[model samples]
Target: MPGERTKYAWRREILATRAQVSPAEHAVEAAALAASNTRLTGVDDVVCAYVPVRGEPGDLRMLDALREHGATVLLPVTGEPGPLSWARYEGPDSLRKARYGLLEPTTETLGPATVAEAATILVPALAVDRRGVRLGRGAGYYDRTLGAARADVRLIAVVRDNELVDRLPEEPHDRRMGWALTPDGGLRQLGRDLPVSPE
Candidate 1:
């Protein structure tokens, strides 16, 4: 198990840095992030993504781009703190306020197992290291949920360019991201790839 204290420290520092990004800068980054994400999916592909809240990278446009590119987008239907259930994302209007200030799809839930349908998963992360260790918010929702997906699924961590860091503490339960999607870096493979760059 990784030290919770170290994870908490990393979360605090990254969030503090995210909080400093101005709205204008964030919007520009979001657009670029959305553009890059479009390359990952195509018609009929099942994609699991999330609504970016707080200072997380990208925005509704990212989801929209995926949908417009003909992918079936699924957003998390957050309930208690276990594995997250998923629902088909119709559009911005399809979302309703949910627990933790998240916007979830009003469409019928496809259940937690629906994650298995996705070819790619755009995960929300505070930071990700070259070794594919992802630093997420303290909640373990993703760690629990991702374990159910197919081993070959492309687990992509969505973060700002600078949020891609040198290293992070990892717990045995922590799910490793296979790729990192950044505003500038686009899609970069992790782990064996020593120098991260767009794929």
Candidate 2:
């Protein structure tokens, strides 16, 4: 089992640093992040992403870019404390404020298994190690959610350039990411080459 003490400390350190980023700099990074991701080639599969809140990098523009790339984008409809349900993202105008300050689509709930249908899953991370270990908020929502995804699904963590660290403490329940998409680097595959490719 994973200890909450280390997780809480990492979250605090990462979030405090992110909070100091000026709005102007954050805007520039967000733009670059969107542009970099949208330019990725051969991404036509359904993309599962989140509507980043607070100091998390990227915005709904990233989701829109996925949609424009001929993908069916699914955003999370957080309910309770277990696996998350999904809903198709129509556009910016359809989002409504929900609990925890999240903006979710007004579309019908598509159940948590919807994560299994995505070829790509973009997660919000405070930091991710080169070994693909991801450091997320202490909530554990993503950990439970990712447990239901297909084995071959491409798990990508969204973070700032500095958040891609050399290592992070890992636990048994901690699901590893296959890539880290940063504001500066766009998309960089993590872990060793496994002869497999992602959409």
Best by TM-score: 1
Mark the 10 consecutive residues where model 1 has the least summed lDDT. 190-199
What is the TM-score of candidate 2? 0.91
Cα-based lDDT at residue 165, candidate 2: 82
RMSD of each: 2.4, 3.2
lDDT of 2 by residue, 114-168 (tens): 8999878999899998889999887889999998999988898889999998878
lDDT of each residue in 83-186, candidate 1, tens digit only:
99999999999999998989999999878998999999999999999889999888889998998998889999998888888888888988899999989878
Question: For each candidate, what TM-score against the reference?
Answer: 0.94, 0.91
**Clashing residue pairs for model 1:** none
Q: Distance from true position, residue 102, model 1, in Å?
A: 0.5
Candidate 1 segments whose C-alpha is farther than 4 A from its true place = 1-5, 194-199
Candidate closest to the true structure, highest lDDT: 1
